[model samples]
Target: MAREECKALLDALNKTTACYHHLVLTVGGSADTQDLREELQKTRQKARELAVATGARLTVALRDRGLATEERAEFERLWVAFSGCLDLLEADMQRSLTLGAAFPLHAPRRPLVRTGVAGGSSAVAARALSARSLRHEAEGDFDVADLPELEREVLQVGKMIDDMEMKVNVPRWTVQARQAAGAELLLSGASAGASSVGGISVQERAGPCDPSKALAATVFSAVLLVAVALALCVAKLS
Candidate 1:
């Protein structure tokens, strides 16, 4: 079971890393190209799918204890590879947004100024001013809108990976330390038949599952939902 899970995790990780690399390259080349909008949309969609799939596999691997030391080491290597790629992609995206590269910016339309009105001169000026103000406000909002939300989605995905890495590492190190201590105690002539160690009974050591697992799962689900919604919005905008 552990071997199978490890294989699945590696497969997902490989695909995700490949997708990330592709995204980084594509964005680098086409950030300012207006004609590549559809290609960028497709690339983003593929990347999102791979990211979500890889994250799910990673969560399962962390939950299962079937992975050996070497397998876990390989997993970490693959994770770091993709995580770095994600960071690069995010940085490129930020740069693109700042330069107004990826998304096209249209000039705000100038309000038409009416002249030679024979009546209500002050009232006409007030109404034109109000219209101009509203148009400016709407244009300002639209120009700055989508970039932040997209940036936030990237950050959220990074956070999810960081949290999962923490969850796996903490328990793994604790188990290794306990094993090392046990080995030392035996070498130093501690009783081989001791029923307990460090004031912890066998039953206590085998206690219930960690509560953080549920919380992490919930967080993962919410992030995935937000990602999907953001993808849809981007698709529509494109």
Candidate 2:
């Protein structure tokens, strides 16, 4: 369907939304662009409205799809890809809107004038002065109010699903450590068995690898290994 609103929205989104990495490394901080920030916020809000309307049409288009299992899967995949794009657009726009509303753009400075409070004639001027003073104070409040908290993730560059993971080196030291742990386990078991048959004193025969102690140690080692594996997985995914 042809839509000017959709076109405008897409254009605004495409222009305003840079790769997270681009924003951080290239665009720098949002501090220096007062006029640009206001314009972007207005553009973002317009795009969001258009997206909500157009997205409804997209949902219907999805429901209308009719295909074989393989083709249907492909169509669904495309839909999902488009949905991800939309989500990124919306999230970035919303992030800017929230921050912009809290700390508005700066206004141009106004000229100041001095007034006297000397007589009856001055009383009229004093009333006008008081009204102007209140207006100036309100403007000052707008400028000096607390700033909002920034979202660090907005600065994080978006990555393709394929870009999330990469091969990592398994250090030789890691292999050696695993081997050492295995050897320690084997020695403990051997000592336990030898003590069982050595005819040593009761307390001495119990040995370093008492059944419970050995089990606990093994379990702890296994847990540590699992924790390490999990940490590796998380690092890769992140």
**TM-score of every prediction relative to native:** 0.41, 0.31
lDDT of 1 at 61: 62
List candidate 2 segments past 4 Å from native: 1-16, 19-31, 65-74, 97-238
**Total clashing pairs for each candidate:** 0, 2
Candidate 1: worst-modelled 10 consecutive residues by lDDT = 28-37
Q: Write the per-residue lDDT of candidate 1 for residues 94-172, one digit (tens) a residue.
A: 5545443333343346312222234667987676566645665565644345556556766765675577566655333
How far in Å is the alpha carbon of 49 misplaced in model 2?
3.9
Q: For residue 145, what is the lDDT in candidate 1?
A: 59
State which candidate has the highest lDDT: 1
Which of the numbered candidates is closest to the native, going by highest TM-score? 1
For candidate 2, the 10 contiguous residues with the lowest summed lDDT are 160-169
Would you list the C-alpha lDDT of every candidate in the order shown? 0.55, 0.46
